[model samples]
Target: MTDEEPTRSAPPEAHAVSPRFAEYTDRLLFGEVWQRPGLSMRDKSMLTCSVLIALNRSQYLSFHARRALDNGLSPRELSEIVTQLAVYCGWPMASAAVSELAPVYAERGIGAEDVAPEPVPPLDADPGMELRRKAVLDASIGAVSPDLARYSNELLFGDLWLHPELAPRDRSLVTLAAIWAMGLQPLLDYQYRRAFDNGVTRDEISDALVHCAFYVGWPRAMAAAMVAREVLVGDDGEDHA
Candidate 1:
């Protein structure tokens, strides 16, 4: 962000990035490629967040986490993405990402010292959907791997889902997109139902999946749509009954 820092230059070789790697990744990749066309820097940063979290790139996740905030994403939103990604990308990565962010929060003055006492609770929002969401997650992932199932519940649901910054709708969208991009079809199917349980509309979920298709691929989008149809059917059945 400083003038002295080269905005479009390759990452330093001393940082273990080879000159060749720098050409493709740092210089051309970020500088020329990501900068080329229609997308704004803010949108690019959000995309970067999705990719980094999907790849479990802890170091880049930290780097881009700060950039995401600089581009207008909040700490709470970043936390939510990391938490949601844990369902697909795994928790060790999320933990590493949270570790990467602690200092950034300190520097940004996010704690009590920055804000006066408000009468409202820190997390005053409705949390009722959480229990229902757990049932969906339990059913979706419970039979798979215990480690994955446990992390999805304990860390993502218990910790990040409770963050107050981003709305549940936004959080669910990010979760759905991340899982979709990661090609975790089963989890995506489960999260499709859970997203509705958290009050996300079928239209919003459909739109998000559609928007992500170009980046994530038609196959993944089709799979997500199939799952979403099931959710809609289930809702209709409940309504008719």
Candidate 2:
């Protein structure tokens, strides 16, 4: 907010565009919503960057990537985040993020070692989780594209999700942000529950979708929220008859 700190703020020229918007951004968005309890600044930064990366908003993403690193996302963790996003958000968006963030990483003196990561041990095995995942994929896509199912099971979830650079909770958060940004309704349905299974709290999930709105837009965020509600509360036992 000062000359000494590269704070998150509206551009100085933003006033010329719309003083009202700039004021709301500074006062309402940053001052209030970002400070909301339960979500740490670091996690919020991670979520924000994930949404931007999913939407391919490279301009804002590069700016926020700087803050994300300062907010405790390591170069390796950020790299892994982009890698995970590749599947859900597509290779092009993730590739573009890598291109844009390269210089930002350089400015921070991030060496090759900083982004090089090793896979960790497998998740403590859970038969239920495995079965549920396979069943859902089989029911949804296996009928049409068995290859996609096999790869999603063997490569995407089996290999990629176990990368140690990013924790499971962070993976769920990043994935949710990306899927929500793209308005992938089916993925949102499952990811909301995946997030909960990974220990992301309900409040955190709500906050994440809310954070995603700024970058991905309201319609997408709203659709994500509706799916989250269905997953969390389950039609509220309302009448279907």
Candidate 3:
């Protein structure tokens, strides 16, 4: 006992976390969730922006609007998300969200340079992609009406989707979220599938829906979850990557 040191205390006992809740977090919330191998946080941000706008959840949109900035999302990208939703989600909702975000932009002192520049698509891009896309539109619209098909293809695919500034993944994520936010479950289903084709993964797409849930509601989250499960299981077995 001359100069013997006291024994160190054992590490704190590991408390048992609820398996039910743990499963929810691990399987539904975190596990492979949002961990789609190649997806980036920025891509998720674009999806969040579109869904929030579509659902008219300006409050959460305002919060994530800042989060997006912190995560390196550019003003231009945010602007595009809001603008793109304007056509589908409506102008009033997008405008309101913009108003909410104005103060955040001011707080961060984001200037012109931090803003995302307009994107440009390759001139020699594949023309066949358009025809293939119509297949998606036709599947979504079916025999009900041509308007939805035209809008999805001509406006969403033709104009906004072609922007080179934003990657196809970003466009797909945003479009899928917008469909979910608008309560267009059928369209959401198709877009969610298409998103995977455009290089988005189930994990990334699910997280976007989760982020959207913070703004929208549980219903939309469930809808996104359903889609994520289907896609993750390789039902389509197609990869946009």
| Candidate 1 C-alpha lDDT tens digits along 1-241 | 1223235355566346465565555444455555544544554566567755665666766677778888877665666666666655777767877777778777887764333232444453346766776676678778777677778677767766666566665676677777777777766656776667678776666555644564576897788777677666665566311
Candidate 1 stretches with Cα past 4 Å from truth are 1-48, 56-71, 95-155, 233-241
Task: Count clashing residue pairs per candidate.
Answer: 0, 0, 4
Query: What is candidate 3's lDDT per residue for 44-120, written digit by digit as tens?
Result: 56666776677777877776787687777878778767766777778899799889888888888876666565545
| Top-lDDT structure, candidate number | 2
Report lDDT (Cα) of residue 48, candidate 1: 62
TM-score-based ranking, best first? 2, 3, 1
Worst 10 residues of 3 by lDDT: 6-15
**Cα lDDT, model 3, residue 101:** 81
TM-score of each prediction: 0.54, 0.89, 0.65
TM-score of model 3 (CA atoms): 0.65
Where in model 2 is the C-alpha error above 4 Å? 1-8, 236-241
Give me candidate 1's TM-score against the actual structure: 0.54
RMSD of each candidate relative to the true structure:
7.9, 4.0, 9.3
- What local distance difference test score does each model get? 0.64, 0.81, 0.66
